[model samples]
Target chain A: MPPPLITARSLVKRFGDLVAVDGIDVDVQPGEAFGFLGPNGAGKTSTMRMIGCVSPVSSGRLEIFGLDPAHEGRAIRSRIGVVPQLDQLDQELTVMENLVIYARYFDIPRAVAQSRAVELLDFVQLADRADDKVDPLSGGQKRRVSIARSLISEPELLLLDEPTTGLDPQARHLLWDRLHQLKERGATLVLTTHYMDEAEQLCDRLVVMDGGRIVAEGSPRALITEYATREVLEMRFGRGRNEERVDDVLGVGERVEVLPDRLLVYVADGESALAELHARSVIPESALVRRSSLEDVFLRLTGRTLVD
Target chain B: MITTRILPSALLDVRSPQRLLERNAMVYRRSWMVIFSGFFEPLFYLLSIRIGLSALVGDIEVGGKLIPYDEFVAPGLMAAAAMNGAVLESTMNVFHKWRQAKLYDSILATPMSAGDIAIGEIGFAVIRGLMYSTAFIFTMLALGMVKSAWIVMSVVACALIGFAFASIGMAWTTYMRSWADFEYVPAVTLPLFLFSATFYPLSSYGSWSWVVQLSPLYHGVVLVRASNLGEWSPSLVVHAGVLVGLSVVGMAVTASRIKTLLLK
Candidate 1:
């Protein structure tokens, strides 16, 4: 309702002769958690960089807060926080010093920068290690420090590029909780991730990107319902036999996706599909019936896994 | 052609660079040994040349004037130290932060631009050079090397030399792809320091005197030597002009190069 915090029209980014981000359009409304989901080299990072006003757009129109990124970069960058794909924390400086100096970049007064740094370190649960240099911290702690540093400016919008790419499960859950709290406080978030579950958990709406193009865009459930069925029947046969009799289970569901070790049957009722498979004497080594998810929708649209 | 705006309002946003300088100061506060190590390098060169080498090489002629060998070499060493300080910060340190540490990548995400990073880095290099020069000048004064009131201008000369080297070093660093590329820095700077008349008169290398004159470090050595001995001449203007022009051109190239590299 607040006139879309960001809008990109035919956004394109080229690195010499390689077109990293092809023509695409995106609009992120205020207070929304939007995601760009894709595998490596899908141009998610390029799109995020263009939105953050750090990378120049090779050709196209990008506007943040109604200002063009090419000419008004400083103005736009001042109000957005970016957590780059890599943890660019200053290893030479203490964790607390990192946040304090970042705060100063926004021209925050010294005393304010110090105090805010204290609070942010506490927020990221790195207060105990505030005096320690980043080199000694764990991967998760370093990421938390980077997140805290990005928040030093109290930005209106936050751009997180692959925020949880290399973290453990627990660390990711912790970061997701922190991000949820931020969203609850009405902070707009734009994140890129290859993790389907991360997108389902964090993004209110997301677009699936592949080879520099958007293949699908919708909320998790809406995408599932539109591109997939209500439930999925997964049956895995012994390694060499999974694809042997694939045609024997043909019309049991709306569609069937064959993977290396399993067969995914998309149907309105997975339990009935399994029953039909049994009735047809197509016994599997293992069978599972569960609700369809974004993973199914993604595979349906792109014909490729999100992580590959 | 890309817009060649000098100190464009985009770059004139000085607050970000100020922040970068503060960050370096904070890091250095904890690692004082790094600063301490830099101090002894120039001091050792001065002590060895003044005490040991000066015994063999007595008074030397410089700029049409005869001065004590220690006096002539001290200020030249000071200028060389300025070059060393600036080049260390701009080339190796900047390259490390850019390639290995990714420090500027984080800074550029904020309101700071690549120009801010380059300026901030050069500003810190100048400050470090000033620290070394101030300490070197003090040591020279303690050794009774001050010849006239014009010696005060050496501080300004040191800062100018540092800025010129810092800008040029940073511009060169943009092209470095790996650590192997850094070997050229020492290979080039070492020869210039030895041949810039830092230890003996440029005339001693008769056939190589023109090479000495061509070295930027030589101009710095001449500038600081003239200021230390109160030997003002129109040549001082030429030395100052060359250093200033080098700084301006280096800075302009560095700014644009950094913009292209990081903002790509």
Candidate 2:
């Protein structure tokens, strides 16, 4: 078997009295795409920082490509690419200069850095704006340049934190495609995101975290299968109606959850669950049936609510 | 055993700190206007305050050598300008990149360490300060204000002064929470600029001259003025020693403060 590209054994991180990551163990095998899916303050970024060797672990062990992060941080860092949550491109530099200078930071030769920068700019679809200053680029263009800059060193492992957080749908899809291409080339990817579709679409394996602890771990498909039914029936009652009284609405599902804004019925077939609600003489103001996804897995693990 | 190899690789990246400094010069090549802006401010001060006001103040006695008011004030403006340029870059520009743009956070993710960043930035400031001082020296020479060839030493003195201010500015910038915190920099700097004998001689202040001697800018101006007047004394050694001491202390503080800010 190929070696695990990354391994963490009881890793922990603390900031003063607040424990950001609490004894989390993670393993990512070679060529696999791994994700940390959680809401804000869920310790996902903290975990990634430790793996990137930028933040020191408070306790326990972490090995990137079988090298210790503590003693071999620079070596580990040299072989890894990181896209931070916020774009950090130099505003004073042109887009191409941003890439070339970043390559220079890793000691890449000037000619090689220049050629690779051009390739990466083309890859990110920002070749035409190469000479434009970074400050004038739109949000998505800046993000693309940032991702391109991260790849300047041809890293073995790529780490992205909220890679598509603020991007529009079209821009997000473009970024996702670029990331897919990177994975196809056999690089290990580790990412953190709150977007369920992002996790389901990209991650081969993932861990769900909340309050600094891992609550679930599996493939996106396996996670949904274990935590939720194949389909979900959503019903939104009028604002004046009490959603907590969801049991009166239907009886066709194995389980039901009453959220402040809606009611979710977990079932093998969502269409049958909707029909059962109609038979009970209960009318939802709005209703929809959808396949179970990472969203359901997240709601089940962290309770039915969105967290900032 | 293997870890030792990892340790050296961290420091062995081909982009030495020197390369980073050279990159700043390349950036400056394209943005020469920004650097030229620093040079003109002092030249404007020399023209407005010394030339314009000198018509009333007449000649001034500096270091026991009678000289035109413009000639006496020119070297002090050069030193003050160098200090200003370095401080502006290290403080305002550095703070903007650190807090607003998130630039250093990205650079630190690469093979560069906080120490490299501190040195790289100061090196850029020194080079820039050198440019402004050199240009101002040429302007003085053209105006027939240079009393001796020793004015070349003033350029080096100003660069050293720039390093001291840049280091201190960088160290203080870590504590700046907002743009408003910068108000105190000029509020304090302007007082030193006015009272540090930049426009007049230290002895002209009579018994209170000792207070003027205590300011760092005063020491810098004294050294530059002494160099320009060709009156090198044992006190010149004391002035150089003070500027050197400031640079060391400032650099030590900045290095430690930046490490804390970046690593934390």
Candidate 3:
């Protein structure tokens, strides 16, 4: 792989007495989709903001493109794009003007900016709403417009903070498809998300963070393999009886996690584990056999779900 | 090779102050009526004070000659007009965009610097003020208020006031935290409008005459009045210098504040 595009050593961000991002180290290689996977308030956005060069690093070193962000922020930012947690598109301007005017900030010539804006709007699939004000667009359309605006500069590295946090599943899938195409075309993506499915779907490598520190870091499959069983048997026992049956489920699987409404039996083969439970006359109200995923990995690593 | 790599982008950065204008212009274009609406407040004041209040107040003496109440008040109103436009754009409009609209959050992610935002915002404010000043000036001229060539200096003074007030207004905006904090705008500007010798000569204030000169609008009013009264003095340079100096300081403070706020 080529040299990393971003490097942070003991990275820290503080707001008054609150330490938003504690000392942590990370490196993002070029042309790869890297993600910060954590629950909300886990310092993912703070780290993203620091990489985007909008927030000042309180201590330690952060270098993007091998230049210190403190002194070279404008130059570093010129080549990178940022999509904040919220859709901050210019509300008064039309969808097209939002992208075109943003291009002018990078000093793109007017004619070139205009042409690129047309294509970007088409890329985000908003060509029909080019002249419409952004205020009236749906949440998904507004997000697409914001995405198009960030791409107007054709940045080398795109930083998206919670790109689909508030979107519905259909909107999230649509955005994921668009992002997948960009990644296939070799765009470097650095995104933060609380959704394990989003992280697993987009990230080549990710770090699981909890409360301002990274708990684990690896590829999704590797993280799951290293931290979780191959499959999980989810059994619900007539609500309020899940915890009472925990002693009976002790030797059934590799391990068991007792949740409020269900019992997650982590084992190598969930199907055989469920059959074994039935053979032993250990029945449940309902049972589901599935592969262990990044959510399970996150729960194992942080002892809490990725999203509340 | 080295020069070719750096020159074009550097030139663009230097020219980015107007990028702020292009952004705001697109927003204001569809809402052009709202922008045009700012022109009429001072115009109405001009008409009402000229037609109504002049009859009640009669004449006032300045520079050893008696002048009509309307003549004395016109220059002050023009200065106040410039102040109003500059304040509204730099204060209320900027606050809305920064806090409610979150416009600069996106702009800060670009290559533009805080100085660019400061220049762009103050430039827009100054441009808005200039249009108002021009409209009000023509009204004064049509009323037979120009006997001396000094009236041209009023335009220049209005431009200076625009620059000074816009810069100062932007600097003040960075200190604001919430919409409630904006009440201080009229709390401060209203008093300046009334007591900055805007409607009356400073001589009428008696013992408080010296305190009135402390007002930034007082310098603007005095400068524009000098041009209207056709009484150009070497002391006019001091008034002009105060405004120019304030513009420089206010712009520097505003740029730094914007950097701290948006880029932090």
lDDT of each: 0.86, 0.84, 0.88
Candidate maximizing DockQ: 1
Reference-based TM-score of each model: 0.95, 0.90, 0.94
Per-residue lDDT of model 1, residues B113-148, tens digit only: 777787889989888887888888888889887888
Better of 1 and 2 by TM-score: 1
- Model 1 DockQ reads 0.84
Please identify which of the two predictions, 2 or 3, would achieve the higher DockQ against the true structure.
Answer: 3
Ranking the candidates on lDDT from highest down gives 3, 1, 2
Q: What is the TM-score of chain B alone in each candidate?
A: 0.91, 0.89, 0.91
Clashing pairs in 1: none
Which of the two candidates, 1 or 2, achieves a greater lDDT against the reference? 1
Query: Runs in model 3 with CA error above 4 Å?
Result: A305-308, B1-15
Of the two candidates 1 and 2, the one with more favorable DockQ, higher being better, is 1
True contacts kept of 3: 0.93
Considering the true interface contacts (CA pairs under 8 Å between chains A and B), give the fraction that model 1 also has: 0.89
Q: Model 3 in CAPRI terms: which quality?
A: medium
lDDT of 3 by residue, A196-257 (tens): 99999999999999989999999999999998899999999977899888877778788788
lDDT for each residue of candidate 2 in A180-215, tens digit (9 for 90 to 100): 999999988999999999999999999999988999
Which has the greatest TM-score? 1
Two-chain DockQ for each candidate model: 0.84, 0.50, 0.77
